[model samples]
Target: MTIDAKTPEEYISKVPEDRKEAISKLRETIKTNLPYGFEECINYGMIGYVVPHSLYPDGYHCDPKQPLPFACIASQKNFVALYHSGVYADPKIHDWFVAEYPKYVKTKLDMGKSCIRFKNIQTIPYELIGELCRKMTAQEWINLYEQNIKKS
Candidate 1:
């Protein structure tokens, strides 16, 4: 889905009302632990947490004009997803999340490498999600990305 909203509030407002609370809670949890320098905006049709252009002048490696993506919350057709760049870039972080999740959430994790899909909003482990969101800063992400590129 193409995100037409220009601002985070506008994006949030456009979300299905049934999902507003869960998305809002997820947004808030992310914000609470998000390090300074990352900004929340509407990106790729979702509420995206990003490393603003001001901080990373080059922007995303794939698209220099666009800000680097860090994380995001999206209301998809079938589920709500929380996308975390940290987990995608760092295997240790992904492992930590996988090992820690079962302790906090009873439902099986519906996750890919980076996207955690919540088929049922009530199944989300809010605290664990917040901590995962808190795990990296913009600089840390940039460093990790650079390291990966170098290894490539």
Candidate 2:
């Protein structure tokens, strides 16, 4: 669903009723565990955590006007998605998550480069997500982004 929300609360309010609680919990989990320096906002139409321009004035390479995105949570039509740039950029973190996922949820991991899809809302592993949020700090993400993602 395309939600044109200006704030995180507004974004949650626009999601499907069934997904509201899960999204809210996921938001809280991310907020509670994410390292300092990342700000929460509505980014790419989803509730996102980003490295503010104050910390990384260069901003996102794709759109310099925007902050450097670290993670995001979206309630899609078929599933709820958690997008973590760290997992996509760091192979160690990726392998760790992949190895740890089966212990938390019975279903096979459904993931893309950065997007982890939770088709069954009840199966969403909030704790694992929280731990993932803490795996990389804003400065660490900025370094990784510069080395692996941002083009010259």
Candidate 1 structure quality by residue, lDDT tens digits, 48-115: 99998898887888887889888989989889999998999899999999999999988888899889
Model 1 misplacement above 4 A: 149-152
TM-score to true structure, per model:
0.94, 0.98
lDDT (10s digit) by residue, model 2, range 1-152:
66899999999999999999999999999999999999999999999999999999999998999999999999998999999999999999999999999999999999999999999999999999988888999889999999989999
lDDT of each: 0.87, 0.94
Model 2 quality (TM-score): 0.98
Residue pairs with backbone atoms closer than 3 Å in model 2 (clashes): none
Best by TM-score: 2
RMSD of 2: 0.6
TM-score of 1: 0.94
What lDDT score goes with residue 144 in model 1?
Answer: 90
